[model samples]
Target chain A: MEIELNDSKHTRNSWMERFETYLPEVVYGSIDGIVTTFAVVAGAAGAELQINIILILGMANLFADGLSMSIGSYLSNKSERDNYQKHLHIEEWEIENMPDDERKEIEMIYRQKGFEGKELEMVVNRITSNKKVWLDTMMKDELGLSEQKKSPLKAGLSTLVAFITAGAIPLAAYILAYAGKYQIDPFILSSLVTVFAFILIGYIKTYVTQIGLLRSILETLLLGAAAAMAAYFLGDYLEKLLV
Target chain B: MEIELNDSKHTRNSWMERFETYLPEVVYGSIDGIVTTFAVVAGAAGAELQINIILILGMANLFADGLSMSIGSYLSNKSERDNYQKHLHIEEWEIENMPDDERKEIEMIYRQKGFEGKELEMVVNRITSNKKVWLDTMMKDELGLSEQKKSPLKAGLSTLVAFITAGAIPLAAYILAYAGKYQIDPFILSSLVTVFAFILIGYIKTYVTQIGLLRSILETLLLGAAAAMAAYFLGDYLEKLLV
Candidate 1:
């Protein structure tokens, strides 16, 4: 294989790599976001809010959470890349000035791997003679610096977009699908569909996380249950006291 | 100053580097997990659940979410290390068998970097003289493999155990502190405290995310509001309807 790492090449494929890195999160995140959003809308509708109010809650969640996820992903990646570059610059400068000391380090490395006598010396001499080859080797083997840098733009765009799109599906299901089904209170049907979405979202987590399919599905279902149970009991007690 | 890039003598403090690497996430994840748990407990209490029940919900959330986060971090890192190892094995075999091809690849690499004539040939001859040196050069420069593989068990355990610990804080606060208030009316005080934690978590997102802090805080707060509001309403209706 070719010697010397190409930083620029890595930069070129960064967007593609970032997309690949984020692929798993997108599907799983969408399911989670959608389920959570549905829970909010359904809960509101159950509490007897207007249809418009339920929709407003869904929209607000979509926008707000999307923005937060986007920004968080962006900043974390940027800082990590910044840290990498800072170290790289120093490593580059070291190669330019201290060739002798650097060569000694190479000789020792070969020594550790069972090289000895003139063979070790010759190997170190050859590698150290070339500055570019030496520095690239140190960066890769010693520093563990890889070509992967998380892209802020890709992260921000993907997460925000995913959240919005996923969040919308449940809202749409509640409005178009649920409202059509109920001959009585249109909103009641909406609640059922919304709760159903939570279970589905929880189930999706198993695939993304390799969490047992049964456990993931059940755990997510419990989140919904806990939410509903907490709300209902509090509402029941508060209704008694407030009235 | 070392002119050689393969220098192994790094003067930088290892402890400092490690501390910097992990400290921020530790603080962020711990505080954030606890705060989130607090909010859930508070909202549950506000819905007027008994103190014991509110405590149960908060405890459940803390353990569940914390475990989930820890497991995710472990698996993802392990997969990355595994993938890197696979690439490294291929490079190792290539170095062992195809000296001529590997030498050509090295020459091709430096040629692209603007080496030519006698100087280029000298550099290639010097690097390829020892196969180990050649292999080292190729692995570092071309393949981008690092020697450090953070133990999967350690990372996983740290995240999972830390999350669970952090998650416990809010539950403790609800059970011991808030539950004692209002003659042990566990729900309202717990929810109010939870909203406070949510507000705090939102505010931290600014620092955590490196974005418009106000927007981040606002978004998180909205999520808290919607979750609590939905729980109250949906729980109310579901309880009545189920009966």
Candidate 2:
């Protein structure tokens, strides 16, 4: 038999939908990047370390960490997708081998939801008649699984790109300072830049999660500040002990 | 009327249940602590700064950041609880004043669930008879919210304790070195210590989240290493530019 191809036109609107799918990963990756990288800079500054050493360590951390995060994201997503497929297969097998048992499960599920008598039987009959519908219902109601179907590669790529882009923010001040154009302490500038990055990330997070914008921004700022404060004081105390 | 002393004997079993509830916060706090503090140590070492300076900054960071994290956790949790309570009040008000409309919503909700005829009417009747049950069904089915009565104070306390306890692991070597007891480079020792901490945290995370132990451990290791590497290199690069 000849196969009929059912293709739909891809448009800018579709691409935007895909972008929305990746938004969570982007937001999380960016937040992780800026916070961790800035913590490094703050630590170095607290130690009164030379600018050169800070640059080496910070740069190493930025690229290396960003790549590693992306790889980890890729693996995690891949594994989740694998697990989902495995379950899907198992569900399909059950439906094929034990039709009666599977149909009863649907009946019981509806019965528990207050369905009874003719209505309950009808729901079971209607759902079990369609293989696809039966499978979907079993997957959701019985196994509590939902199909996400996000591409692992795209997830990883988004994380990597967002990481590098956001991770560079704090370091920008230091880089500029080292270029002989700015006379101020690079650490001071780094702090200012990082705070701004934190606020921006928090603002973006609000858009994605629909949290109150001001609350999100303040929360991010507080969290970053807390991390830096702990690092700084700890370093100071240890220095005193050595002295 | 005599008041019933609705009291049960307090037992260790109840406390264990409470402990289980705080497990997620502990895991996250510990992870945050070790990673952020270690980032500081790595940054300081990269800059070739005085060991004393590193210790000072690191210790300062440990305490300050831990407290800050705890406070932030408290506020975030409180806000969530407040929002939930506010919505709950609104739901209660609607149910009281708009009983007819609300009952229709309940009926529609069940009908959509495939309940029909006698079963659909029973489901609606049973639900509408009890105010508390009706409120709960509306909250969950219509509002899509479930009550999560996790205490804000407990969450904050858990985060603070975990932050200090786990965060201290990486700094143990530095503290020992500062005491003039360890001859080896403290940074090297700290790296080893922090890696162990990362693995330990990952292992605990598995127990909490039911993720594969090996995968979790590896992910944690890579993430921590990536952060340190980026911090170290960036610090180095900036140093050269300044020179």
Candidate 3:
């Protein structure tokens, strides 16, 4: 039987389809943003700092931490892609230079799966005939590296955007208070808004984690509360000491 | 051909072998512990708090955060295991109660795998004849879940042990200063030690991450510094505002 190997069509995507690709980056960024930003707010509030100082510090941390995280994300993903490409190049060179050894390796892999005798020879012949398929098999089975599908630059951008967006939630109440738009205490209002954001992010996270909605929400709330409480009490203790 | 489905023997283990099993948990806990404890140390030091107070808060956070993390780790693992078992049961029920549908699924699955005619029927028969094999294949291919290998209790315990052990590194200098054993500034010493710990943890992380040692070390250092700096400066600004 003749074997057929065709490259998959890379279809042009609608805008919504493209957005789905970065949903994970967005969720991750939002989660980190909310947790860190709220921690800053909590710490400042615990220290009884002025509202303006709190807002200033929150804004500063929002951008600084967001940039730092995005840079880290970009570098890590880029490094992974580079590493995979390096391995791919080496495997391709080996296949070209050492066909017999490469064919034996494929035989060994299929033999382990119970293909044997004439069937094994036929399977090997079919795979080796297709250069693209041979390369893919070698990449996956030999190197244990799959293709990196994500765009590092886009991942970084998504992270920065999500961080700033979700991170703004914690500071919103403080900003409103500073602008003389709301009468409620900014700290209390910030806490409420942060909790709301936590629940919202937790709902989004369920899409990724596949955990129960309530459980995910509770987990997010617990994590945020723990980080914020730690920072808050540390700031409070330090203030007491300085006084 | 005779099919073999013997269960692998559970061997008696050396303590070292057991420790290896929890290595990931240990690394994760250690990284988290060091980052958080040092953040406390950095924030307290930035606010110019008394050294004793810094140590007190650092130690408190060391255990508290460790416990929190371990609990989170335990619950998450337990939930995952429970979820798996729940699905497993559902699959089991379907296979027993509606064998026709399950067998059709098996046929469709193999047909998609390019198996055809007699071979397709043979593949389905081979899988469905043994209930255990059928269940395993369904669990893997249909649900896209593998067996949970790590024990929740052991994972949690590992996290706690690793957290306290590695987390102590940041506070060592503070303890020494509190005991009047060191004349150098405790905060300065703590910073140095924390950096050292970051390097060490990064090296250990290379085992799990398979990233280059230098890159892992740099990543760890960058992450720790970013968090500590944020906390430290936030404390400093808050102190300034209160004063």
Ranked candidates (DockQ, high to low)? 2, 3, 1
How far off is residue B193 in model 1, in Å? 9.4
- Candidate 2 chain B minimal-lDDT segment of 10 residues: B1-10
Q: List, residue by residue over A1-243, the lDDT tens digit for candidate 1.
A: 234345444665656666667766575456435544554554444344445444544444445444544554565566556655666667677767876666766677656545677666755666666666676555555566564344667766776677677777656744563346535555455456556665666565555555566766665555445544443344344334332
TM-score of chain B of each: 0.63, 0.91, 0.91
Winner on TM-score between 1 and 3 is 3
Identify the superior model by lDDT, candidate 1 or candidate 2.
2
* Alpha-carbon TM-score of each model against the true structure: 0.56, 0.70, 0.68
Per-residue C-alpha lDDT of model 3 across residues A1-243, encoded as one tens digit per residue: 111221112245757556876887897788767876777777767667667656655665566567666765676677678778777888789889999998988887555445568766866776687676677667654554557678999998999899889989999998799789998998899999888888998898776666789988998788778867876786687567643
Please state the Cα-based DockQ of model 3 relative to the true two-chain complex.
Answer: 0.13
Please provide, for model 2 over A110-172, each residue's C-alpha lDDT reduced to its tens digit, 9 standing for 90 to 100: 665556787678667766776776776676556655564689899999999998899888888
| Stretches of candidate 2 exceeding 4 Å from the true structure | A1-12, A37-50, A53-108, A138-144, A185-188, A191-195, A228-243, B1-24, B35-50, B60-160, B184-188, B191-199, B208-212, B222-243
Model 3 RMSD, rounded to 1 decimal: 6.3
What is the TM-score of candidate 2?
0.70
Please name the candidate that would achieve the greatest TM-score relative to the true structure: 2
Q: What's model 3's lDDT at A51? A: 76
lDDT of 1 by residue, B1-243 (tens): 012333444556988655444444554455435544544544444344445444444444444445444544555556556566665667668867877787888887666555677656766776677655676567655665444346665665666565566556556555565435346444454555656765665665555444465765665555455444544554444334322
Question: Is 1 or 3 the stronger prediction by DockQ?
Answer: 3
Q: Model 3, residue A84: displacement in angstroms?
A: 8.3
Question: Candidate 3: how many backbone clashes?
Answer: 0
Ranking by lDDT: 3, 2, 1
- The fnat of each candidate, in order, is 0.05, 0.34, 0.01
